[model samples]
Target: MGTLVSLGSFCLVRFAVRLLLLMFRGAEASTFTFVNKCGQTVWPGILSNAGSPALESTGFELPAASSRAFQPPTGWSGRFWARTGCSAAASGGAWSCATGDCGSGQVECNGAGAAPPATLAEFTLAPSSAGQDFYDVSLVDGYNLPMVVEASGTPGAGGSCAATGCVVDLNRMCPAELRVAEGGACRSACEAFGTPEFCCSGAYASPATCRPSTYSQMFKSACPKSYSYAFDDPTSTFTCAGGADYTITFCPGSAPSQKSSRDSSTSSTTTASSTYSGTGGGLTLEDDSWLASLATGDASHATTARGPVPFLYSFIAAMALAYTLLQ
Candidate 1:
């Protein structure tokens, strides 16, 4: 009887160990690291899909040259954007941002999403380790800043697993008609004209009908890898292997040495010299070795972003339960 009881206790402990491994594995599947390389502060806002659970923070302040990390569970889907020029209303009034405001009146966006004219990083993580994750940097709503999304993991079969983003500073060259004078954001043609064609609404909802407008063409010319219009899935969407972590960098790389231009009358293209004078002096768009270093676990920032406390606690608890059962 004693021997039988010992065997049963051992089996229970083994089962508990397996269960804890599965739980932690799911927790570590997706770690989002947001790096703010901009010269000014960036308040990043997150909005989870209807069926997804909220992360530890819906929004938070990320100062320049800093980064923050979050681990979302499997099957999570959400969109992320940065708010600029934020401040509190005098005398204990509502806090607000000049661009990409979630209108939650505070840093924590809660369930709110960013207002228009904000560059967005959208993601839908795989449900399991075997599935693929779909992600993209979208300017369909317009652009406020330069942003990039880089995935790090084992490449899945039939997946591109490439980095995609708008690294150029679009605000400097945005069409005068679409430029937001106060906040330096660039509005989409839909927001500027409010026409059904530009908005991809009414009769132009389908991909076949909603062709890219001249404005979207200009955006596409500048940021080819980004979503320039409503139906830009072909080039804008990117996929990675399951269990990959992503790093979203704002104001990535040095200022552009050249900018893209289009003449409406002649439909001609011209390139102009431009540069981004952000504070990220050591990083440049051309040199992506730093990103590769991150993937190989050579970057110091990558190690600091993930903590082992949760796993440690879980192991302790499981061992304690096993000990009690054995006794």
Candidate 2:
């Protein structure tokens, strides 16, 4: 988990912070700057490794001049969106925004059978800072996920570090690695950003491959000898670049909380609730929920999951073979 400092729309956040500090001494005071990417804030709360807390959304409104987005607590996993100053009702859990991409005016978190929110690249956010009263969020999601671009002309070089499918690190951006290479997404930017006629199939990789609404973004300038690949933000971490002259880093609009053992545990152990809403617009959490309040992590972290996948595969294969020969 990372820290989400100031989100967009900071019209009244500075004032709110002043008021919050006056009340709760040492309260982290993480605020939601994004008012409405698409939906209104229904249930606002500050997410944390310990747990999310419903904020007093009596009067929280964001400024109309920010580009930061919302952020989940250190332990929670979700997406946040916003720009500049945010306006929200801390006590009332309401938000004021003209338009946002929060999904047809509905924003929620933590639930089963619930579709994962749109993927955000460079899930950017400004950590609580002095300059801005609210958080600032920016990310790289060509498709519902963050992205790093790489080019062939400068693989592992400047700008090329993030050409087409670069890996977005928590604190830094790097070349996105490929499980399978040599086509589609090149390991270099020179190859990725060249004319489409140079690519393997005369097509440049784009996120729109997944969503039609984003189809226009599919076409690239054209690559010399490069290809593009999409990486899943939740799991993938390494990236490769085709060229190596520059490293292009996509600055996020906001940042997540610092990663920690406890928070990692929560991500895996905690079950998705039936419903969970956000503030600013006062989203209602789901009732009849079954999500467990637990920590998550690798086996070494006390979280229990299936044992080593390789060992399981071997055993299953052996059993299958034995049964087959016997029959």
Please list the C-alpha lDDT of all candidates, in the order they appear. Answer: 0.75, 0.23
**Which candidate's lDDT is highest?**
1
* lDDT (Cα, tens digit) per residue for candidate 2, span 283-316: 1212201101001112121111211222345445
Supply candidate 1's per-residue lDDT for 46: 97
Off by over 4 Å in 2: 1-60, 64-73, 83-98, 101-327
CA lDDT, candidate 2, residue 40? 24
TM-score of 1: 0.77
